[model samples]
Target: MKQLIIAEKPSVARDIASVLGATQKSKNYIEGKNVIVTWALGHLLGLKMPEDYNKDWTTWEMNTLPMIPKKTGIKPLPKTRPQLKAISQLANRADVSEAVIATDAGREGELVARWILQYVKFKKPVKRLWISSQTDKAIKDGFKNLKPSKMYDDLYYSAIARAESDWLVGLNVTRALTVKYKDSLSAGRVQTPTLAMVRRQEEKQETFKPENYFTLDLTYQGLSGKLQLKNPRQYKERQELEKLIKQVEGTPIKVVDINEKTKKEGAPLPYDLTEMQREANARYQYSAKKTLSIIQRLYETHKIVTYPRTDSKYLTTDLKQTMKDRLQAVTVMDSDRVKGIIRNGGTVLQKSVFQDKKVTDHHGLIPTEQAPRLEKLDNEELKIYRLIVERFLGLFEEPFVSTNQTIKAEVKGYIFLFRQSKVETYGWKQEKETTQKRVDFKIGQVIPANFVINKELTTPPASLNEGTLLGQMEKHNLGTPATRAEIIEKLISSELMERSNSKLSVTPKGKQLLTLVNPSLVTPELTQKWEISLEKIAQGQLNYQAFIKEIEQETTALVKEIKMSEDNYVDHSLTTKVCPDCGEKLREKNTRDGKIYVCSSEGCSYRRRKDPKLSNRRCSQCKKKMEILENKNGAYFKCKNCNITEKLDPKGKKNKKMTKHETNRLMKKVNQEEEQESPLALALKAAMEKK
Candidate 1:
């Protein structure tokens, strides 16, 4: 009898199949004498939408909301039902004695396989293959110690709770807000809190007040020093400043003390997904999602990196044995760095980097045994690969050592201090550090210095960018590493957030939604506390049913809050177009997919997808993309924002600036296209223009 092994994606399945000797490939699965391997397309199924359970849930009605299902269920995604059917058929195959769950060895991976099995009613006993890397040895050992499926029952329960809780909280709150306010606004347990944080940051920026202050500065031969004061920079009165400056103008500066010490700083831990994304954002301005995609390609296509969606920045102790091979593989990418580490006796292993207990679902992302061909990488891939490779090599390099010298002086009985740092070793990676000039000073040495008032203003906090936003989200436990990128992106897609370059701005709609939301719902503490419960469910410390009960109660209360609130909502998105179905004003909106016009009425069925027929011409006033507007009058260009209109430039017009040769070149191209135009199409155009 053969054991059926299921993997998370086709690429993973092929890797497993090749290793397990499942050489007989078929359309759905690969089979061998003792084993068969198949794959899932990320997620083949998801929780059923509200409308699936009852017809009343179809419309966005506040009274019919909080549409709690008797039981949340699994449904095959419409586009992937064929694959789900194949997996079910393979599970029921008579020759397969048992099943192996070889999906990604994490909570989400478990859910992917469990849902498929539950829907198929696969009754056979099952085992799990939990391994971090796709190396041959790792896979072999993982199979040697296959875990019982029952061991991860708690994890499955936690996964279910997470999904169901999102549906309950997100759907109920979103529908209630949409209906009550007569606008399409979405809120979530994780994203609402995240959005609130963003709005809070914007509010802080908007309300910030700056105060100008002055600091007393003293400059010597080549060094600058600051004199100590009660309120360092706040010299409230100009007379008091002039008095202090006059008092210390010609005073001799005496060095009272010289204190120095040497210190060492170890290399940073390897990249988790969040850290990797943050670094990519800092250096290349790549979005978190973009970084994730690039790293995934490096792992799957190039086969040079390990898994991408890890949280731990430390490796398992067992990885020590494979360090040499990993080190050699990375040398192919960075010969000078890795080769030097290998040439010298490897450096001392820090316990901070090899703790097993600290590792969660996966260890820190590192390079694999395969030597990376630098030429094979795209520009961004090369950057991400270099980042991972450098971190991997850094583990074997020496720590950075530096010494500091602090000089203390007195001016008119006021204490003054200065510091200079000198690096003793450029260790680990060649990072830029503070380099100070070598200066010699003695105790009780008096030197003349000049002082001036260095005036400055108190600056407001920096705005939230994608990198800082991810860091904050992680700090508050708002979402998982795997889900944080999408959460930030979803806020932008919902039009709750606007972005200019890296900085994020909360739209007026986002602020309105935040004000309407329950105070408890928009605080990170609420969802963060719930995350604790989810973790407990995963560890078997808390029952999943109990968690679900809490979610149900929370949902009921949230819906009730919306129903009872005295604050009224107005649909600000109202447009000039009248709804054909209910005679309400339609709202012009932009979605990720395209533009759409929706009726403002809660129950109205009138909504149309408007193909704006965007134009290449840019608006002169706002510089936004213009849309093509064609009517009985004539074809014209209209700017959506500034309402600027200009008639479309007549085609085949000669460029006055073009030289004869250039004009001929342009005319030749146009003539070629004109000649290709069919006779019937030309005739139709002519007839329509005449009308």
Candidate 2:
């Protein structure tokens, strides 16, 4: 009997089959002497929609909401059903006595294979292939040491709980809001709280006020060194600062104290997906989503980088042998400087990069078993490869050493202090110039401290931009590394946050939404509560079912309160123009080229593009009026009211064109702006109303 092997994608399946002696290849699978390998296109099946149960409930309505089915349903996507069916057939074949699950070694990947097996009722004894790297040696070794499938049953259970809970909460709340607000809106456990974060930031920024403060700076020619105030700001009142400056004018400074300490700076932690994404965003101005996609392609397609979505930034002790191999891979790419660092073969392994406590889901992103052949790749691939190389090299280098000095003095009874630093050793910082730009200070170098006695100075009020505010939020546990990028992206995409010259500003629409919404619903504290509970559930310290029941009870009371309240939701996108066909109101939308007029009433689906050419050209009958209509065949613009169709070339400069993908992406923003209900917001709002 042959052993059946299943993989997450065709690329992985082919590689596995090659190592397993599977030479025969097909469109979606491969074959070996004793094993037949197949692939699932990411997810072969997903939870079914409410419409699947009954077509009558296709349109969302409040009465039919809270549609919680006792047993969840699943269906294969129509376009990919044939491929899934083939996989099912192979798994249940008469000659196949056993099967091996070779999907990704993550919780989600486990669920993907288990669900397919459950749906197909494949009763064959199963084993799991849990290798992170897809190199020939790793694949062969993994097959030689296959583990029983039951070992990962707990992981599968945890994943199922998460998926089912998301479905229950997301679908019900999404339907409820859409029905109540008369707009197609969605809410998710991840997406809603994410949106709330953006809204709150906008609110805080809009209401921010700047305060004024004054300081007295003392600059004097000193025999030892120049002197300046340590903590400059003395008072908020101008009269108070003037009194201090007057006392210190023309005062001879005296040295009070001097202190020095030697310090060593440890090497930075290896690259995790989040930290790498943040750096790439800051350095290259690339969005988080774009970085993830690029790294995913590098890992799954090119097999150069290790897993790209990891949270941990440390390698396990077992992976130490591969470190040297990884370094050698970089050397093959012609980086002599990095190669020279490893040529000495000195013992540089430190406990900092080999800790098991720091790792959670997986280890940090590193080079895979494959060599870094960046020249063979594209621009995006090369950029991602360079990041991995730089980080990997940084991990093996020595820690930086420096001397920190603090000097103190008193002039006219006014105590002043200053700080300076000098690098004792370059260490790992020598690889990057940006990392090496440390300010150097000698033990007794007398220099200007940027302050003079009797000089007027003012302290600017503290303010935070999007980036700094994000940093603050992260410190408070308001968002995770994975979610931060998405939150920022959503804020910008929703037009709740705008960037002008790299600074974030809140829009009028955003301010209005924040004022109208319930405060507790849009605060970071709500997510903090959820995150605490989520961590408990992950650790098996909290019951998953009990958590869901609590949420349901809270949601039940909240909805009733929202209905009783007198708060009115204003429709921001209301338009005065009537639809030509149905006489319903026409809503304005932002198209790729410009604004477009679309029908507001459901099922009408009428749309008309704004004609710039017709608006520009003057008509003969009425010199002020412009042509408004054009024939179907690329001809001339004609007046809609006058019915005058004139033939002309279509190559005028006034014509605007855009691809369908670009047009749809721009239109989606307008659609989202028209929506008022947020799933997470609605839930919290409903609960707060009851309170």
Candidate 3:
């Protein structure tokens, strides 16, 4: 009998297989004399939706407001069906008596593997391979100390509870809002509240009142240069600055306090997805979506970084033996640039890189055993890899040191103050040229000390940019790494926010949506509570069912409130013309060039052509109308409707190409898939197939 190892993705599976000596590889699984390895494509199976329970629920209707099934079930997505079949076959093999769940050590990862096992009805004894870092040593150590799958039962329950509750609240509320508001608006547990948060910030910014403040500059002559205010300490009134200026404007000031304190600056904490995205956004002006996509490719395709989406920034203590190897590997890959930092035969061990407390689920992104090969990667991949390497090297270097000076002077009756700080050395900052680092300085080491009194200055309030705004948001955990990128992307896609000069500004549509939507739906506090509750459930301190029940009750009350609201939902896209037959308002829908008015009232035989497509054809994939490109052998159609391109090439470009045999096989496969439908889908079909 062999041990079966299941991983979250193909890349991770390959790494684990290589480490475990499973050299014989198949379509999706690797085999050895004593072990077999397979993988889930993120998720081989997931919780079924309400529509899976009944065909009638496909179209939104008020009657299906609270569609709760007695039991939720799982189904494999169409694309991953083949992979799921392969995994199930491997899991059920008679020789494979024991299984190792090597999926990502997270809630979602646990659910992805567990659901597949449950769906396939596998009865093998299962163990879990929970490792944060994807190094060879880590894998071997993890295998040696595998724990029973039952240990994570509470975690699994929590994950399932989260999925089910999200499905219920998200689907029900989205349907209710769409139907009641009579628009295509969709809301969710994470995104809706996130959207509300940005809107509030925008609102506060719009309504902000700026007050004028005054300051006086004091210049003192010194050998290094003119030293101004070391600290940005504020002044209460303009008269005080003026009085100070009069007293010390031309007078030679004496340095009274030369306070010097030794400051041991620590290296920066490691990179998490949110921090990385924020840094990229700040330094490179890259969008959050772009950064995430880059990191994803680096993780999945290039295999240069380990689990880029992880929230943890520390390495487990068990990984101490491999640190030197990892450092050597990095040095080999990058050479002299990183090698210079190594001490005592290419070893660079530092306290910042060897902490067990900060690590969870996964360590910070680090260079793998694979050498850095930028030539084969795309520009985005290069950017993400550079970020990872630079940050990693920075973790094992000395901290940046600096000195600060504060000079106080009195002119007439007012006090004049100025301060300045100078960097002594770059330290760790010198290791990686890209990573940004800041240091605090000791007071009164006046290098640029040349401040004169009677100089009036008006401080202009600094405007918000992506970096500063993200910095502030991070200080207050308004969003998580997994969500921050999606939130910013949502703001742009929904046209609720726009980027001007690398700064985020709210659009009119964004402001309008914020005002129109219910306040609680967009606030961050709601999601915070939800996250806290889920955390509690994971800790076994809170009841999962009780948490779910509360969510259901809240959602029900929200739906009812939306139904009873007196304010009419406004569709700004609507036009002056009303449907001729139904008297319902007509609205302008988006088109390639402009907009077209279409009568949205149900069962109304009315539609106006404001901006029809210049050409007529249909996209096979999306089943939407599009413009056709006629050629000799075939016509190519680009679906302006859904952005799908279909081959109709006269030059033998395959147009929905499928052989008669292939078509028959496909239909048979579809039938087979339908036969193996989920528990929810089977029940729904049995109950409502005839209707």
Candidate 4:
């Protein structure tokens, strides 16, 4: 009998089918000599919503909350029901005797396939094909040595516990807050804590008090020293600094001490999703979500990089043998880097990069053994690819060697120190050294004297950007690398956080929600503690049922506290604009596209885009074409990605004048341009061919 292999998505299923020679295409599957391949488009089902179990749960009433059921049933997702039906039939086909799960080889992936099996009631023996990348060779190897599906039972349980617990806590708390405050506020097991982090940072900014301070610097011929008073480096008062400046006005500065230490810094760990996202955010100013998307394309579309969602930065010991192959793959791109890598890595691998016990979900993100064509990469993809390449190359290169020089100077009794760093070797950074900027001071050497007073103000902490937010999320265990970007975006889209250029600032509405929610709900430590327990469940150290009970208990306490609180919640997003239909104040809300002003009245259904919507014409500011949209009033044009808008000029007076023929011709030209692949698309095509 033939075996049926199910993958997480069609793209992945295609990879498996190609590798296994499943050439014949069926309705929702591919057929081979003895095997059939089908795919579930990501998740075909989810845990049943509370309202699905009880009709009363549909209404937003606090009385019907804590919507706990004895057993949460699963249902087919409406959008992919047809595909699900097809896969179900494929799984139960008489020719199929056994099944294989080829979904993403992670905790969430296990749940995806297991849920499909449970829902379809597939009774045949099941095996799992677990591999990190979708490269042709990796797929073949994974299928060659498939593991029993039971091996991932604990992982599936862990994922179910997380999902069901999120539903319990998120749905109940969201309902309670919405009912209490009469605003659409959401609290998640993970998202709430993530929002809290941004709120706390804002609190720091609001309370910050900048203080002005002054420093007196004394410099002689070749010696420089900052004047000190009472052993403090800077004078808190300008008057105090001036007094110190006068005291040492004529004192000659002389070198007191010079010290040097040779130091070496080991290469950084390989790219984990968080580290890569952080680097992209810092260097290229790309958002975490953007970095994740780019890297995912690099992994899946180009087959150049490994899995993008991994948290581990250390490779397994088994991967050590394959390092040379990975290195060889990049030789065509940079032979010098490959040569350097081979020189150092031909022996034992770096001790820091091969710790098996340190690895968790997957090995660190690395390149597949597919040679890259650099000329095909676009600007952004190339930037991210270079980062991964440099990091991977570092694993095979020597540690960065440097010598640190510290020089000390004294003016009368006051003293100051300065530092100079010299690179002994650039090793992995691959930078050329042409000049050594250094100041040499001989002991007891005196130089011409001068004093200057420098004044500065104490600065507040930097505003939270995507990079900083991801770092904060990682630190607090607020969300996984795969989910942190979405959480931040969610906060921004919910009007709880605003993305200003690069920094993230909490909205006033965000603070109000934080105040109204249960204190523990916003604390990341609670989520982090839950993550610890979930890890246990995945490892079979704890039963998922016990974990669910804990979440239910916590949910009960949180709901009780929220109900008992005498505090009042005011809608901070309430705007003065009155809804024409209901004469109630409009509420400001944020969406992925832009801002919107909606009627506060429950059934009024009146809404307006804060950023004006479409026009077929171009924007005057950015000179980009705009979209046209209509609210209750009239049609307007807006450039959603930029700040450009205009009301309808149906008379064609304000818009660029164009005859019908000319407009049609220009539109045809634009359509032709849109049909072609982007530059990054060219890169993906190149990498795919390399395979």
Candidate with better lDDT, 2 vs 4: 4
Worst 10 residues of 4 by lDDT: 675-684
Best by lDDT: 1
Task: Tell me each candidate's TM-score.
Answer: 0.87, 0.79, 0.76, 0.87
Where does candidate 1 stray beyond 4 Å?
237-239, 576-584, 593-596, 599-691
Model 2, global lDDT? 0.64
Candidate 2 lDDT by residue in tens digits, 598-651: 787876878877554445555566555556454576546566666555556455
Clashes of 3: 29
Sorted on lDDT, best first, the list reads: 1, 4, 3, 2
Per-residue lDDT tens digits for candidate 4, residues 1-691, read: 8999988777677778888888999878999998999988767777776667899876768888777888887887666789889888888789999999988788778877888989999999999998887778888888889999898888899989877887788778877887877777767778788888888888899899988778776654444565546744356777886776677777776778889999988888998999899999999899887788788767766788998889999899988777778889888767876876677645433578899999887999998888887775657878899889878877777777888887777776777766677888887667755545666668887755577677877899888888888888898877677777767776776667788789888777788888888889888889999988988999999999999998989999999988898888778788988998889999887665578898888778888888665445888878788988776987778787785667777675685678987886685445323212211123222322221
Assess the local accuracy of residue 28 in candidate 4 as a C-alpha lDDT between 0 and 100. 88
Q: Point out where model 3 deviates above 4 Å.
A: 14-32, 53-59, 133-141, 209-214, 222-254, 332-334, 344-353, 431-480, 487-513, 516-518, 575-599, 602-648, 651-691
Task: Please give, for residues 131-215, the per-residue lDDT of candidate 3 as tens digits.
Answer: 7557676678889999999998878887877777767766676667667766655555665655555556666666776555454
Question: Ten consecutive residues with minimal summed lDDT in candidate 1?
Answer: 674-683
lDDT of 4: 0.79
User: What TM-score does candidate 1 reach?
Assistant: 0.87
